[model samples]
Target chain A: MPAPMPDISRQYQRREQLTMLALAFPALLMILLLVVLPVGWLAWQSIWHDGFTLENYRRILAEDIYWRSFALTFEISLTVTVLAVLLGYPIAYAASIVSRGWSIVILALVVLPFWTSVLVRAYAWLALLQRTGVINQLLRQLGLIDAPLALVHNTFGTVVATLHILLPFMVLPLYATMQKIPRDLLQAGASLGAGPVLTFWQIFLPLSLPGVLAGCTLVFVLSLGFYITPELLGGGRTVMVSMLVSRNVELYDQWGAASAVGVVLLLAVAAIFFVVSRFVPLDRVLGQR
Target chain B: MVRIVAQPSATQRGRPLDKGGESVDIRSASKHYDAVRALDNVSLNVAPREFVSLLGPSGSGKTTLLGILGGFIPPSSGSIHFGDRDVTLLPPHKRDIGVVFQNYALFPHMSVGENVAFPLRARQLPKADWPDKVRAALAMVGLAGYESRGISQLSGGQRQRVALARAMIFEPRLILMDEPLSALDKQLREAMQIELRELHKRIGATIIYVTHDQREALTMSDRVAILKDGKLVQIDKPQRLHDHPADSFVASFIGEASLLPVRRADACSVVLGPAILRSTRPVPDGDELMLAVHSEKLLIDDGAGDAARNRLTGKVTDVVYQGESLRVFLQLADGTSLSLRQPSHYEAARRIPPLGGELTVTLHPEDTIVVPKARP
Candidate 1:
């Protein structure tokens, strides 16, 4: 008969659990200190003003300007997500199919802009999209238009700048997923009588949906709270939730209203994530087993 | 055992189309990647419903030939004909061929039924008949009632069956297999080999199989095409290939052979280490000649006055005990090593020759083949 192994296995299990906890302690502590504590404080501030009143919530729900800001935020975020995906899919597919050296070069170019600050990128777009910018100057010199087009300080400027900033977030996930698909599967599909377009639609596109969802979710959530690009490029015309929160804090000194707006944005982003996750697994989007 | 219902051919399902089996003719096919020639100018003809295996070692361009046949790779200078139709420049989707990849590249997101129905959907066949055809194909591969199972849920052998079912569901004229069974275990691989051969017979579809396994080629192929270094060495029936290899490379690649350096005495005879060996076939013209003898053809001399033509006496070097047979290694007087295989149930195994003991073996003239040495 074999010796009893329950005690030994139980002891080993306890040690394994302890080791996992020990290894995870640093990250957990950092998240608690940096993220959870601040969010919890903001949530508390949103409701509790000397006696835990619902005044900030009621005021946000009743205000028309705040509602407009929330609507504009979602509209711009959705538009930016769509544009990023449209532009990023082809770039990601090209990177996935090219040779290793070429793929590295493409990926390097995609990531190169990340070295510069987002504010700097936004400022550069401002220079290019302004009335007297290089694009307007070129159009005028070419005799294309008599008047300068209103490219910046509006929804157009916000979307173009935001898409430029969020494109890599969309492309990197797509490339990761597309690169994992075996080349043989496409060949097999073709041999089974699928043309290039049909094969792409049936095999390649479906397999890449996870990456699309991942990139869209990341871009959308990040765009929800986006402030720098819209603020610098929109020229105070395109008002979003983040800009509203800053106005409430900086100009009006309304800490309660600002905290409430921050909390609402967090919940809205979480809700969008929950809905997307219901359709496709979040781990698949992240390319994790 | 589930009884499979008889079904019409892929083209005969509510449509009057050409039958699936079409003869293939590959003429002077070649592929070059800049300086490296993956496939040299080579020509081959495959009969309708014939099972041909392209057998070679790695980097021998067998897979390249298969790819060229499937239209996956365009040859540098060659034309492919499918029943007199020049399909040289045709795309893979327009070729109407089925391909089974080495990794069994089934769509992971699709279920078994959907995978089997992919080709039909690609052809824009009627959706109403898809379920019945999918079921019939699954039943043909002995995997009925598994339509809804996810790809990841099935084992390796089951996935292979799914791939086969998917390939044949459309009743393609030709199917290309690229080392499909190399991923299976030994016993399973052997079983699948027989099943695949039977499947080929039942479907009557022309098959072009590429594998590096000599045993598999001999077991399942109607004819084995041996290749080396982007060149076709020989193409013949398995038994003929084993008996009369065109050169030393074909001899060594087809089976276990020991090529002994010999001098050609004449057209039908050669001088070995110490004895003159006569071959049943005439020797081809070459500077260097070698006597290629299969290990199984060497028999121990029972001292009954046998009339075999060639005899060799050597010292026993070693004996390896296989499960069903014993492999005896002997070194000739001139230091040429020869291996002989004897069944374990044979009388020779009762008393294995000890190391350093004199062992005399006889070989019939018909069993010995003389071929030219490989080029350096």
Candidate 2:
């Protein structure tokens, strides 16, 4: 025997929903203006020439140069991602195990490079790697070479420069994940009669896999659309998808062709994300779990 | 007492491996970090299949001693032996001792079966032997058929059982436990304590357990080693430790005992205030002495009390009802506080005098415990 209360809770919930919507308005608007509009325009320009056409898309499929550019981009990105993992994993492991002060120094070295502009870092590499550059001069002085080696303007130069640029992306996530693994687990492994090497192989490697996937995903995806480092260091020898899109737009003034290539690149990136997410949860790779 | 089962059958149920029980002898073990001594020169001997507990407060170096035994931290100077083999300088993996760390430390990425099979794999046991061995180990810890359960899909108590199963699966003779029950709730902790004691008997492993809980040590250990400030204060059976502490610190640490300052009157007696308290054992040699008053040892003195009992008179300060027992606090004439517990049943509750009333209590000579006062 209590009196029926007024049904104001539903009304209050509606008001709360409105408040949340208002708070989210700015970010939603930014996405619409920055991302949706440009992509929509690209899609529009790719299909519409005078009225509507699939000619530009068909041309990309029929052409060998465009196919070669796509193949080269995948090959270079795969190489860089593999190399970044090999190099970055040891650096992250070192940073994870060292004392606090020394770890700070190591992390700082990784991050300090990240703070500088990609252009400046690429230029620094160019200075050291060019013909008669510091490396070549040193090798010549040491009597190790008769002539300067071709270190730039090829697949080698493109990979080295891109790896330098994207290494922090691979390392920061890996370091964060490695740091979260408890030190007690190593001791527990030892007490369970596992030697250091066996423990590392069975326990540590399996636990840090999320980081490896995350680093590889980031490095590979970023390398696919990479333009600046390859453009500067490759000297037109290595042409990626981004460089092809630029050539269609800036050099040939083919807006339809450029838009088609941009759409394909966007879809490829999306496909990669979908496939990776299917295998491993994205939140875990991002270390949210 | 090392019992080895030669390849347990696949269908065997509740059969834990009877292996890896070896006598441990630690002679003058010490660990020094810079100028601070984590463990002073301490020697201890543990027999095969015996369960010994190292009980102490934090910073008492109980952990450091366990570390020395487990080969995690090398002793600054000492020799340690497992049976006849000297293993003082051996690494942890080579020592062949099971260790249950605080917080369990189970592998997060592994299922229960994989975790239990890790030690066997490290020893390079045949692949076909794993399923049966893992099943046996899991069955021993009361988690039969839990081989496929992920680590995250377990409660705290379940995780503890999994840790124990994984540690004992390889049948190491000696097991080192560092506060393994600390993470469980009170009810679970008590239950696990009993379970662990029974498990020890079944497995026949020499267990060196470290805990700060007096009740846990008393309830489970065949012998308890009490430590304070990196020094071994006393090591004895639970009853001996409670009834005959080596000094004031052990008496206070091991049970609910209120220490009263007294002066030695003779070889068998001590003078407290105006009352001369006599003991069955000779008084310890010391300039200062303390009488340990266990709450349950004191009885209300009637006129017909036995002549062998010593009597003391005090004013009731307070009476506290504690479900099954009533705690009565009394103040002596010289302001020393004494406490005793009485049954809280109807008749006893009615007999308890009002607060501030005079009460006389008697203590038998055998129940009286006196020790040399410890240095602060």
Task: Highest TM-score: give the candidate number.
Answer: 1
Per residue, candidate 2 scores C-alpha lDDT tens digits across B69-158 of 888899999889999999999999999999999999999999999999999998999999999999889998899999999999999999
Enumerate residue pairs that collide in model 2: B3-B18, B20-B173, B21-B173
Complex DockQ per candidate:
0.82, 0.73
The CAPRI category of model 1 is high
Tens-place lDDT per residue, model 1, A245-271, is 999999999898999999999898888
Misplaced by over 4 Å in model 1 are A1-6, B1-20
**Best lDDT among the predictions, by candidate number:** 2
Superposed by TM-score, candidate 2 places the C-alpha of residue B235 at a distance from the truth, in angstroms, of: 1.2
For every model shown, the clashing-pair count is 0, 3
Residues B1-376 of candidate 1 have per-residue lDDT tens digits of 4634334553332233235468999898889999998888888999987899999999999999988888889899988998889999999999998899999999998999999999999999999999988988888888999999999999999999999999988988888999999999999999999999877766777899999999999999999999888888889999999998988889888788998999988888888877988878887787798888899999888766557558989999999989898999999999999899999886878655789999989888888799899874
The TM-scores of all predictions, comma-separated, are 0.93, 0.92
- Supply the global lDDT for candidate 2: 0.91
Query: Every prediction's TM-score for the first chain?
Result: 0.96, 0.94
lDDT of 2 at B297: 91
Q: Report the C-alpha displacement of residue B338, candidate 1, in angstroms.
A: 2.1
